[model samples]
Target: MTEHPSLNKKQKQLEPFIRDTFNQEMSSNEGIKIADDENSLKAGDRGPTLIEDFFAREKLAHFDRERIPERVVHARGYGAHGEFELYKSLSEVTMADFLQDPAKKTPLFVRFSQVIGSRGCNETVRDVRGFSIKFYTDEGNFDLVAINIPVFFIQDAIKFPDLIHSVKSEPDNEYPQGQTAHDTFWDFMGSNPETTHMALWIMSDRAIPKSFRTMEGFGVHTFRFVNKEGISHFVKFHVKPLLGVHTLIWDEAQKLGEDADFHRRDLWTNIEMGNYPEYEFAVQIIREDQEFIFDFDILDPTKLWPEEIVPLQKIGKITLNRNVDNAFSETEQSALHPGNIVRGIDFSNDPLLQGRLFSYSDTQKARVGVNYQQIPINRPVCPVFNNQRDGASRYVIDRGKVSYHNNILADNTPSEVPVKDGGFVTYPSTVQGMKERKTAPLFKDHYSQARMFWNSMSAVEREHIIGAFGFELGSCLSSAVRQQMVNRLARVSRELAEPVAKKVGVTVPEVEESTVTRSTPAVSLMNTIFVADTLKIGVFLADGFPGHEVESILKQWKDAKLHPVIVSNNLGEVSGTGGVKLKVEQSFLTGSPLKYDGVYLVGGTGADDYFHNQARKFIGVVYTHFKPIGARKECISLLEDMDINGKPGVVIEEDAQFGRKFTEVMAKQRFWERPSYLYYV
Candidate 1:
């Protein structure tokens, strides 16, 4: 057990209130049983619901009223409840209870979202993912409303509305739902020029994450950490997955969107199987006096503090160990804001963050209700007692007269707490600036970092980014939009812009130099982490010849902590060598290999030619992506006909060398070493 910073006077008082409120909301309300909330009430004959169903009505009403207004952006989302366990204290940097004490486990709720989609939109679309976490600590609820992408499209908050409006469904037809492949988006990027870095990110594999568990999360804004002595330091937050960052190919992502529910199913199934996702909370700290050391403005959300300059400090681990009991009640109703912070954590003058501080709570009130914080999922676990009363769905029972301050009634009950004992005191940074709005000169340079990102990508990652750009531009009916985007790309790198232009059948734009010349190499996907643990491999087999072989391979896989599912043509006992049998987890006709991290073929007597053919097709796909492939002697013979021998990640044995070879090959994961430049459809 590690010691975390203890709750001060206020948090200790408020803790019971939040806990009690959570209990009250979870309890039976008006004879409505929420225990069995997963299912809906049906008639005895299973024909229709009974009219006298008050419980059904309550559930439906709750569902219907559940959708407060979807966020103008980042509307489609999924959330989970978890705990953040600190690995070490950061008392030197800040006095935040959650950060200073390694022993305290703070319960947190996290929401992962698609920036351009609606509440019911697809998950795998090529868009920035919202990775927001709200820590319900004893001090207060500290919300880090962040994104998977490390940077923003624009530097200034004033341009935020414009950026969103351009990428959203067009005002005229409202067509191109949940996509940026259109005129306005390209036109904005072309004109702004500053969006080049983020545009590269949007084009990269980072936009199409394989899962929320596999993607990296970033605060995307410079903040401040204040200690007991009122000293401030610039800071950035990062959430690196222990499993490492991973993404699906553009082609796979599109197929995934053919069923928009793909991510939801993947998450739910994995959690049900006890594959809990974990992420390490890290921070990039910079002393306040050293903010000027970087070429780019530290406060610019569009730019990143290169990791080489400030390496990430791993402070804690956050595990999504439990799934939401009800999606609508918890995931949907939950609200997150960057403004929520504890005593030690404080905000910087980042314009984007300032805008978000105003936007989140305001939008929540409009979407949920006037008293949105009173919503069970949104409410803090800490106690909230004040003169604030009488709003829509306001459940608090203020005991006694005088709800206002400084009145004789109720003897000034719920009086203000002093700051010395424990009260939120905003870091008193001096603020004096002209009222007129203008973007700082430091925010202007954007193409250099964009070029750095493009230059740093691996060959495969670069190709996907180019392909993504082409695919998106090709979807645009407007020739002008495509030309404008091509022109914008030329400023970043002509090498990048030319291929995309040719593929879209447009002439490459002329090289136009931008004012910005500084590049930060740290902002590239090529530099992200990768590991094989938890990688799912679909093993397609029938009544197999070698049951022990399958079990042996499975044992090794278990040792490696890799997930191997024995799939078959049908769900039943799949007999192996010497009549040993393994239960089929899924059938090929029912599930696709695209869901798996890899695939293994095990031949047996029960497998018909049709089954072989089906397995062949899926195996071909797994091989095309250079994913791990495994087979025994008979299985090797089967793959040889398809010319799969000698391919990278292909494991085969002439006799019984299968288990050892397959395990070694699978451990390496995808073969980026594969020389095949050919793109397999």
Candidate 2:
């Protein structure tokens, strides 16, 4: 077999399982050649097939049983092959092989998904995103199942089902497929004060990310990392995108209704175009002795360790470079579990994490079959040896008569190894507690962190949060649920509660607000990294355009790693001055302003009224979204016609530095300081 530059140990291992029929004739699953398949061995033309025909029966049976049960949540997902390179050794905190070598590149697969939607739901909905990564390390497969939100709705995993059911479509009517703007969701929130912190987070712009590449991922539950000396330290995992955390405004996100696969398409297209997504893997480590130093419970999944207090230590980087060859085979069938840890990593006493350790394995068995681990995508790159046999879809065949441990027949072959010999040994920590359903005292103080989240937001982010609350609550038909939620919010902050209460026609009650005045600036998107690399820009063009200036600006944008696609009235070659023709990638009807990061208006001298009107409409949407806009000096009149010239992010091509200035503006992603009335107009 030929070697590929991108091939890693896991990719090479998958080679033997990858079936190729590119130049082969049609054959049955049993390897028999088939002369006719389309007719299906019918009695006559368009006649019913007979059961006597084995080929027809086999084909129909496989087709009928092809689909497996969809996941209870995170049904819609996209995955890619990647490698994780450790930045430095962490031998002091963990004995995991993947974290021990800085030069080694561990092969991995990452799946990004929406948490609340079905397989057919819109990808741009305001919801939590799952960012699970399966690291095919030397020790074993380590699955880091994470979400874009650092915290969860409930502190314990026992309430996971209740949380999901409430946010899903109402049981009676089944209305509102992929949204939380309904009565049932608010009703649950009003009843359970434990969900307050996560509710505030989802209401913010983080729920509506611009792209999966710009989202932050977190392992919500605190875990333990054991060193070679058997010392344990609390650890929290994080994945920060190198491009920075960016989000789509509510209006812009709603306008993406026509493109249901917006996020999925963006991820696939960028990876295919060689613009691989990159993220830094970091961890927040807390000594075991310092676990109870915080006001909130360290084991609580609903609370986040403030980055200011516990700084993140960057350890590695992940780069997703290859898209999956078959979505169903690799992405859909792949199983990830937080319990799939290596020898160095151990579970914490976090209630949610403990419950998930059991739930994920059970669900995988039910959904993918008992022998799901034998599936190529979920198989470990390391050698497998076990005395156990399988049931359905079993791929491995044990050659010996002994299927049990300590068997005299085979002299106890496949014997377990000791801890010193590379066997997994769980951390021997003391455990002494009475079995009870009650939670810790600190877990009951849910409003403190919620208030801290509210205090951390910038003015624009706070406004967006208010707008989101208004939309969600206004859609609810129940006044009592809305009032209860407002009262709960008042406990967090009256500044947040009063506006939302007024908007939803509910009165805020007299309640003492949270005394926590502290804020974590790292939680806010206003302080995120900004870079123009790989940001898509739509270049509006037409016939009789200035070829030289357009070509120069395009080259400069490309040099700065910006993706520019030509958008005109129609597809095909668009003529410019001096017979310079550029190929139009998309027409006005085919491409929407919501699809691009920014717009470049270069209205042509020979353009028709339709082109101008479409350009105006496109720029209007871009301006309203507060996205950066660039226009040629000749098209200043066009911007004036739309009454949007001299806007905060508008960059006119009146000087040689226009391209650089425009690129700089696009790097900022959005101009939140734009007049609020423009958004409504």
Candidate 3:
């Protein structure tokens, strides 16, 4: 295959991005083992297997122990390290060291994961993403374990296991590797209607984020903040991406799994290009007395306090400036527990959160041994001295002979400090729950917010959600499960369930309006920010192209901070006009546009018809999916002759300013303004 002139130059730029992603995965991936090249263990020229062969025994032992318990849920995950910088101090509301001091930057580890997929599952699967962040603060480690969506599957922790079990691959066959439309999942949703609000979100495009960097994150449960004077206020954490909440079309998401690791590559590449992903850490602070003002219970994990009710207060920025040194040591070994709070931060009455406080510590013991905090990755930057002594796998070297408390000879070494001396003091809050097990009555109604979410989406978003539900339900073999799920959705909205019911070959059930009437219009992604500062452009070209013209345009894009990738039929240099040339970054046989944010057509006059065919095929894929497409004058004929000249996102070169105009279009991503009926063309 002939190579593209620009592809080589692009490859040089993308090299670090691709390499770092592999390094991270290889370090953390326990299953991958390099095969030994020597002969197999045997006795007398392979007459019998040798029990004395240590290598074979080691290999077999490792293989047999390969399966550590997968996460009960969210088994598949990708992680990165970053710093969170505060914009201003909130000293009046909290005395937490990280929040009060603007000069202090807190180091944090964040793991983005898929809820339903196994460790080896695809990146673009239709499921909620776990956006859990562990902040290594000066006071202590505080974890804001959250998800991409603002709500959850169930209101209480008691139902968490049930929700996870039902959504998981059936116990018998372990079917549906990275999906949620199976019989058990739908049956659970049908039976437990509290999941209605989250079901609306799960069925929407938000479930299939375009990239981990572009999605929004939320602390699904309410928490508390205490001041030095012991003044407490109810609060919820929000992580709004600077790039904004965006998603891929269902078709593109499905196609991305051909490589399964598409998102991992995209993230690593963008960060390596010095376009580190960033998000604004925002919060919704509600005074304790005012918590009862909302129609829905603020403590319910299954519901979100709509932005309209409590506007997000932007306080700081979280930039993932550095990739991990080692995946296993830094990214994987890092532990996050909600109970790891500073003096000012405290928990709320949210039942699920209360349960998580206990669950995380218990799980980490199994995942990283008993003394998990002693691990370098999980250790705090500040000094950690304590009276508590050794446990399993304790790596810290504590000196002195006396380890117990109140020792006269030791003079009470590592004694507890006073609260005034920067010591942690748990926030004082009253607890008046009965010994009996029960749920809040306010948590009973779930369909109102679900209906609001459905009603809030634009026509396109609504269609995507319906399509997502249909696809998931269609995958289930049980017709009864499919029918029951659709029947339940009808209560949220007839319009939402009608399309899904019809597509799944089931009759729609009669449903009454939900007694719950409150609505949060801002829950939809249509209302979120979507920018294109670092979106990648895959430039497809070959030998004998007008190198000078392409180079000049690429320079303009670089100045605009838009990354461009040069791809060809082969990987190598391609001769361009005026003795100039461009390097081929990836070959058509090796890469796909699914790895890129958009496509650029720079097929030059020097390229042969064969090269044109390959470029045409790539262009066809991008066009069919409403992705941004740009063409220079040399290939402008292809756009015009093919009758795609007036398409919504098609950028035909009309002026020398073609590069600038194309950059603007890329910033907007798809001309989602274009009707989907013309998508096939």
Candidate 4:
């Protein structure tokens, strides 16, 4: 295998463990070659196999135990190898080795996942996305387990199990494999008022992201970043995608549900095509003394420090440049823990975060075995030294008599180092409070932020949220649950609740409206960055089309980093005028308009009615989903027939600047200003 050009310490460490089976004979677990393996040591030619078949037994035994336990949450995930490069030294705020050196590149692995799903669940479900990264720093491994949403359902981790149980398929029938549009979920949301903030976000477009590369990641907890002099600051980590935060419309997302691996396939294909996903690593830091100045508690996991109040400071960039070699070995076997912190980073008093520090490690041990860290994918690149002993599947062999601390044997080897000598030291935070189960008083104001989130949404986003709420509530069989949820929404906004109540067949209650009218533009997806790079455009064609113009346009699109895939009636070469022939990458049956970011129509002179009908279908779907649509002058009749001509985001090739205008329109992604009725149709 060829080495990756930007290989770091972790990649180098993984080199020795990588095995190649090519040109090698299959052998038993003990490296013993066996002949007549297919016969399985039968008594006769057609007799039953005997117990003497050790090779078959070994193979069967391994096969029987091949599957380990999946995660309770975030089971359906995809990961890639990446490297994080610091833009500037952060030694003043954090003494972490990875953040202190601008020249050094820290190797890392990022796993993007859905929160509520089994391993076989669809990837495009409307749910929170887990964006966890494990950085293999020189000091040790630091795992920044994050979520696409900044806030969580509950402020305390004690409600985590209950939250998950409520959203999971109902106990009696296990129906609704990967959706929250059920009675139990709404019932829980209505009962737990603290979930209001996160519920609003879930109902918004953020839940159904366009791709993992376009979603933003938040650490979801306020952590302490202690500098070299032990000065501590409360910090929240953020991962801003270079492609910008984008989401799929509810209609598009529903169509994508047919493809279980949509997001996974997108990530893998983009990486393989050298369109590596990139993100900016940023942080919102607040001085420890200023923690109480904010109206909301900094330690509350259910609230986010509005970016307008605390601006993001971009410190580094992470580029996922390499795809995993093996999905099971590298992606599945990998484990991340919030407790996996380096020297300078320390935990906060956030109850939710504190519980996760224990829960993640415990769950990983139960799921992947006691010595899960010994797995090559989870191992630290730096040398590990300790008195820790073996457990299940122990990879290390301790050849010493002493395996305990404070021992004279072996001259007390592997001694602990002081804080000054690069040892981890927890900040000496002053704590003087009685043990209590109650959270801070500020956690009670859940609807304030939820209302703020509602107010922050654009008109189109608000419309989508209303539709989402209606759909989710309408799916529930219980009228009580639907009514209760609408009443809960009433506290957030009347505009949001009234329509949703009407949709779910619930009577709207006259309640005191929320006075919190402040909106954070940063929270809205409408204000996000947009770029044309790596945006997939499906180029529809048949035969005897304007190939010269199409070829030139494709060249310009490629120059702008737009991926244009040829789609036709069949997979093969499609000949055009002027002796131009192009390879059809996908057939009409294989490709759908829902899968592409945009569509370009180039009608063929030899096209039949069936081909025209298929093109019209594509145009209709693209137009309804509010996606960009481009067409040559010849295909204007098809667009007109579909009643989508002269619509927003519809660019026709009429002038020399058609390609530039189309690319610009494609970068804008969705044209929300289009008529609202056209979206759902």
Candidate 5:
């Protein structure tokens, strides 16, 4: 692993806790070896069982209580230990110690998760992805709780539980585990207009990211960056992945059921292979005075500030270089809360965020024990001093006569410090209003920004959105719910609703065109970064292939940092015409097109009809999915007979410059403009 000079201390702390129970004799909790663990001491092997069997009771007792309550939402997740290094100091915006110095690297642990599912849910689902990070700063633990999308389903925190309940599986059935494309979710959206923008986002390609490493993260709620002078700016945080944003098409997403661990496995395998995931830390800063001037409410969690209006200012980067040692202890027990803010940071009146500050801590307390922070994974790197003592799972012992604060016995030790002494100080703000149940006027107009999002999408993205809407609505048994959603969508754009209405058998209501025709270019997936690095390419070949021709292309792929897996009709060595043999790592039955970013068709010489038939299926799926395909001269015959020659992303290596040209094409990631792109829907 590439170790950052500043992150070594975190590794040192966790090293002592690493357990190596390998090759040890299996025993009960008390270290007693059981003579027979199998058969569970049941009925004494077909005779009457005895209550005196203490070993069996102990094993069964532990197994029955092994599970704790999974998170109410975002239960399915994967995590990695990493460090964040600030390249640009934000002293002008915040006095937050971690953001003030460019020379220091703050160790952090990040958990990427899918919302609205249990811990065992599939990874590829049409739902929001939670992107939470805990920075073990010397000031304490600072958690930035975020999501993949910039907005949310509700404006107020009071409605948060209702929103989650509506999207989750029906309480009576509990059938669907990992998806939001169901009756209750659409019904909830149709009834709640505040969810319009986030509903559109969930149906977009952002929901089904190709990998956790390729998706963007957003803080979702507007926060404050307080400077030493006590001046604060309204800020929205963003995490831009270096690998670029990408997603699987709906068909490929469905195929992920066979390997639901694709997203999680992709992260672990790449990290183990030394392909560390990196993301740029960016933010949109609005002066406190400018917050009230935005067309959309800055504090509304359901709305996003247009990036074109407030450009993203790049500040730093985070590199995830280490995978978690244990899922339950490190990834599960660690609690991330929005309330875990450091000094230079503070909260806004964003209702959703305000509620999350309370909910996260409460949930962690219930999920883990009362002293959850005392857990090894959740403990801070810095020395901690507090008056709090003894609770369940307490790891600290308070010495001598004082466990309470403001006591003469301990000389008022562990007392709070003044704002000047590195203690947390909230920014002073004037407040003069009676508490009431009401939303701001700006939060009421939701359709305008939703319309702007619709206009931002490219033609291909628009088609995908329409297909997503149709599929989701079609799954509903209630025609009224489908029609309601179609009508709600019409408010965003008639063009968007028309196609979806036709497929869902709902009437297209006559709605006026949206006046907000302008689009924010930054939100579109088409505008993301794309490179050839770390993309997986499947190379199909058989015996008696052209070794030199294949080797030349393989060299190009290695130079481009693309991983190529050799595929054939069966395993074992395959002889080439040049007397060189290549090891086959995968076969036709073992390989699936969804597992690769692209495919290379090469050297089909001496292949039987069955072999050729398998090659045809490979090419067809790769082509239909719009991935890049390259075929050498011998393999060109295989692609030619299928009549897929000269397609948008297909490259035939006949000319001398074929290898170079094909490498350049694969760098584009996918061929979205191919004529077959229209055929997928």
Candidate 6:
């Protein structure tokens, strides 16, 4: 199939605005070309700088105010251009144009971020990830403001500020910039037990995703989807990665945090390399009449519908194939709002969802100005009609004399259309309840689902969760806070709490344990899809390496669609024994074992003592992390010395077809059955 010029229709529209500054003379904000930019006007060469240098003054003034106020949450973000193709028509459940036609494709922009971190924070920090996407449908723009995790720390949006405040670094000290492993966070968790479920999620491998393309996304709140017949169903949005849901183990995540922007860099590089990320868009739907059937409240923000109970209906596929031209102009300026819905999608009575409708609108006004939606990235493909006038950064120009409704001059042009003509219409949901600041009684039972989450984990995921809790609670100086967390964990599961209690040096008090022992296996990461395509493999080689072996490995790697990175003692070409030379992509000092999914140790004779020792050091790290290791010829000596040769994920072969076997092991991701293990370097 011939590929389109741009990733989507929306990107094609943005092409004209992309500046061709390379071949053109430099110009000011206006069209006037600049003669010189080296110096400001002055009385003489050494005289005081003059104030009359308009070009210089304009440049400096713009630079001074280049930054906009970063988001209070989800500040550190990266975006991509994509198109969503409908795989199946969801017309039975929704009248949304994008969801109605299988042949139609909707252009979209997705911005992934680390919530609760500043703009400069590392992407690998253990935290909830933001996965907001803006879909440009002909009817209007639909923003699916979602998160990687299905649940949240709080049930109500009113407590959102408190949740962010407590999870952030302490006010007086402002230390520990990117993590929630602190006293204040635990204290808040202890006081508000509603946070127990989400705390477990953040402590699990889900918090540290392997890549943005491998992570799952969820619309945290229950919404309403109305069919053409005006029949409504409570809905939850889900995105399953075609590459499979995966994560960085704690050890790799910690090391990557030091490098920072690891995940951001991965997303950018993959798109640029034409390895576009794809995910299937699905939804869990519950009829309005069956809302009361669930044991938990449907409107609760911190709960999820088990996939087994409410099966997901796959509707479409979203493929991100283009990287942004400018980060700030395309990514930072983009605004997403849950309220930006089409006629088919409507808000539910979910309290968190209700408050977010107001909060997001207000935040955009304060952060990006009232005209934020008019910004190119946020603008809808359809015509925007409104009676409102200008504000800061307003790009639209209304030429009509009258800008208000009920006007005779413009004859009330841009009049609203009826529902039959694809006009907006709210689901006439009848409301009869007291206006009070309270939630339903069912929202109080936070432990049952938390326990279900614990019971659902596979053995490996369970151990990681326990280690996460131990590390997080152990960092807290307050024993009381640690004990409080242990007690809360006991309510979820005794197996989860006991080990954490011992690690944190706390006595786990016995809380009423949840009787819910049933597990939802679908939620576990152990059941995710495993493949070798696009996996980054680090290749270790030195001079005098066998050319045939290296050449053979590269061929299999290319066949498996794996990224082979050459790691040696230094950069530049290294000669093979068969007169075959290879370029070193990264040295040991620059390329750490944590960066690649697997490694290949090809034997080399002409290496320094330091290089030999570094080879062994790299093997130990990879072995400890349970990553797949492929050893050929002389490199087998390095693995043999470690006594981990022929391990579960270690493939050592002196015979032919070594690369084929190694490629198979890389697809499994990690070998958890290795003899004895200790997490962290």
Model 6 residue 294 CA deviation (Å) reads: 1.3
Clashes of 6: 0
Give Cα distance to truth, residue 554, candidate 6, Å.
0.9
Better of 2 and 6 by lDDT: 2
**Candidate achieving higher TM-score, 1 or 3:** 3
Backbone Cα, N, C clashes tallied per candidate: 16, 0, 9, 0, 0, 0
Better candidate number, 1 or 5, judged by lDDT: 5
Stretches of candidate 5 exceeding 4 Å from the true structure: 1-7, 23-28, 31-56, 676-681
The Cα RMSD in angstroms, rounded to one decimal, for candidate 1 relative to the true structure is: 5.2
- How big is the positional error of residue 240 in model 2, measured in Å on the Cα after superposition? 0.4
- Provide the lDDT at 182 for model 6: 93
Query: Which candidate wins on lDDT?
Result: 2
In candidate 2, which residue pairs clash?
none
Candidate with more favorable, higher lDDT: 5 or 6: 6
Output the better candidate (3/5) by lDDT.
5
Per-residue lDDT tens digits of candidate 2, residues 573-610? Answer: 88888778899999999999988889999968778999
lDDT per residue for candidate 4 within 549-660, as digits (tens), equals 8999999999999999999999999999999999999998999898888999987887888788888898888888888999989888878888888989998899989989
Model 1, 408: alpha-carbon shift in Å?
A: 4.4
lDDT of each: 0.79, 0.92, 0.80, 0.91, 0.86, 0.88
Candidate 4's TM-score reads: 0.98
lDDT of 4 at 129: 93
lDDT of 1 by residue, 29-92 (tens): 5744466655556766566877766666776787785445677888888887778999988988
Clash number for model 2?
0
RMSD in order of candidates: 5.2, 1.3, 6.7, 1.3, 2.4, 1.9
